[model samples]
Target: MTLRNIKSVQKTLGLLLTVFSSTMLTPIVIALIYQESTSLVFLASFLITGLFGLVLWLPAKKADTEIRLHEGFIIVASFWVVLALFGALPFFLLPELGLSVTNAVFESTSGLTTTGATILTGLDELPRSLLFYRQ
Candidate 1:
């Protein structure tokens, strides 16, 4: 891919990331409603994800080039990868979970992809925000 294509992908990914970051708020609200301490965790996750997205977007916000077919594939793949990584933030941030990076990413990817798989054993004891996020 050319530099322009790369910039285009970056630009698209940035905007998508920014939008995706807002999703963290749902869990925050859930935490508050359930009176769970996980709200802070979600807040931190939101800031990190949003800031990363903004950093990615600000530089290439002006890219006006069209995305080719191959570029579309790249964008799709990158989108899922980015989502998985960012989606893992809250899971990884919760200290009580004691989840490794691999397990957290796996859970995030599985949740996002609706794979219905889990490494966690105790569902009833988990915070409601986390349970809501998993769904």
Candidate 2:
């Protein structure tokens, strides 16, 4: 959509993403609580998501006040895709687990979409850091 069309929703989403970034620290906080190496990973996720969302928001926000249903679906779908990719960063890069990138994205998508499919079998004894993220 043109920048002239969706300014209000854009600003709202921008603010929301910024707030969401703060929650990213939760993983690191939990990791620190359990003495895991999640602090850096969480910090990275926080900054990346925050900056990406922040930049997507432009001053053109005041132009658009309401969302059409079709537009709503597109926005939600695209946002989930973005979140899935970035949210998986910790899983894919952590030296402790070092899971493949594809696998990480799959897990993230499944959890986010609530699809019930999982490669995270045998989670009974998963590390506290990983389990914390799950919860």
The clash number for model 1 is 0
C-alpha lDDT values of all predictions = 0.93, 0.71
Off by over 4 Å in 2: 6-16, 58-61, 121-125
TM-score for each model: 0.97, 0.77
Q: Candidate 1: which pairs clash?
A: none
Residues 75-116 of candidate 2: C-alpha lDDT, one tens digit per residue: 576667667887787677666666799999988777767787
Report the poorest 10 consecutive residues by lDDT, candidate 2. 3-12
How many clashing pairs per prediction, in order? Answer: 0, 4
